[model samples]
Target: MTRPRLLPVPLAPLPNELIGSYLNRLADANRLPIRRIDALIATGRHHSRDKDDLTGWTLSSIERLAALTGRNSPALIHALPSLAALAQPNPLPTPPASLTPTAWKTKVCQLCAASRGVHGLAVQRTYPHQRICLQHQRWLGGRQLPISPRFHELIRANIRHRRLLRGHRDPLQPSALHDEARTMTSRWFSNNNGPLELQRTWDDRLQMLNPDTESDPHDDRNLIEMVTYPETVVLTTLLSKPHNPVHHDFLAEVIRSFGLDPRSLPALHRHTTLPSSMRNPDTPSHPSRHRPGSKSTA
Candidate 1:
């Protein structure tokens, strides 16, 4: 059968949409086999940027896609902000093996995938700094799925850190922060002990978000990710300077942004345990002076 003059679908720039996704959807709507259409497109001799199985389309490929979709190339490119960097081909040089770094890679948002009828994990969705989808107001739940609520504060902290980087105040990238934050959180949680009520409060909050049977709400991995993610993000911000304020009022502002309380959480134990030399006796560290009787979210 002959290919139709052009696909009729419009390119929707849903958050972090992948080029592979757009192509497959286009193929599905056109009632043509993906491999066949892909092969035909390959014949156009366009530039290629392949990521494993998915090809990160270049400007030339976008033009080909535009011709097939009956859309303007410039308009299509404008819609995909993520691809703007690729418009010009100044690829980075690979670092030597000794200098290569690695950490937990980014993953896609489940809600974003399901909306497009994508299954078994959609596109990579690998923006490490983006743990919570502020747009959709959901947690990224590790694998391509949305877990539940009760993480808005953590999400807010994540957004604030990103804004800091955007404003050029912080020199470290999200990946570096990711590594340090985990280290700090792990050490703090393992070394310090807090009130039992505080521990229970955290556990109960996580339980409310966990899925039913089969997967334990108290699973070690889930707890670690949920706890460390926000802690590290907040810590990264505080650690920006050699010394961070240990005073309850300032600490409260930081924790409040994470939807947490300074008085009850174990994660904040480090600030409490600092040497008296580090603490200011004049500034008390307990129920926040900013707002008395504010309940802890976790």
Candidate 2:
């Protein structure tokens, strides 16, 4: 049987975009209902109650979607990470286990979506470490907080994060380091026990990111995460290296590099060991505490 003609307008998929999101954009572009687009690509009986569910697509359906969207299968697979699994002969089972299931998906930066001609909500699967949109200087994991490009440390941290993900031999090490760093930083931020200079730095960032008010009720936690991100990344990088000793002097020097007093951290003052996660590389890291809309502080 001959397939239906391709849509007149072609929409490009954003990197790491969900296949379902692409279909919705495709439907919106052609003024078709999402179900109609789904029907066009559906190869057999659909099992998902939600039409846009990721599990709905198969290799055959991806081919049909390629035909309808005027894109090749490889291109579709490349643009949508989930499609690569569906293209496999024996795909992994559904409901992939995650410590934080809701965090597996995140909103894409609106500016980035608009650049691709998408002006609506665009969600993509994301790893825990994927937080900032270095391209647009916006926070991807939470309510939109536009950061200034002048924050060289934050930008450099984002770059290092990308490199860590790409270059690390052990896939789990980067995430472990990031999680531990975030935990430690969050503890300090919440306790309000960091050095006076460090506290002022965070306050400065909070003010800059939320200039309209003394504080933003909606963005406080996210702001805290953003303010601490550079330090978090720096600590992560230091711990990721095997040669970097986790001693008081080493920690003190790192604090001094940020132009903050090291003695302010009680851990440093007492010369206690760093968190076990930092000391032992094999320690299982906890899930990130910075999930969107989470009321849990730190």
Evaluated with lDDT, which candidate comes out highest? 2
Model 2 quality (TM-score):
0.71
Tens-digit lDDT track for model 2 on 77-187?
898876787677786556412212223567788888888777876778776467877778777756776767656677778888878768878645666667766777777
lDDT tens digits, residue span 1-298, model 1: 2333565554343344455555555666667666645655553322211122324445555566666777775666565444556664785675433222232334456666667665433343334466666667665645433435556666666787677557544333444545555564555445444334435555665666654667765455546566556666665565443443443344445556556555654445433433222245543433233123444465
Candidate 2 residue runs with Cα over 4 Å from true position: 1-4, 43-53, 90-104, 126-130, 163-167, 170-172, 214-219, 243-262, 265-298
Candidate 1: misplaced stretches above 4 Å?
1-4, 13-15, 43-59, 74-86, 91-126, 143-152, 169-175, 183-202, 211-214, 218-223, 242-298
> What lDDT does the true structure give each of the candidates?
0.51, 0.66
Best model number under TM-score? 2
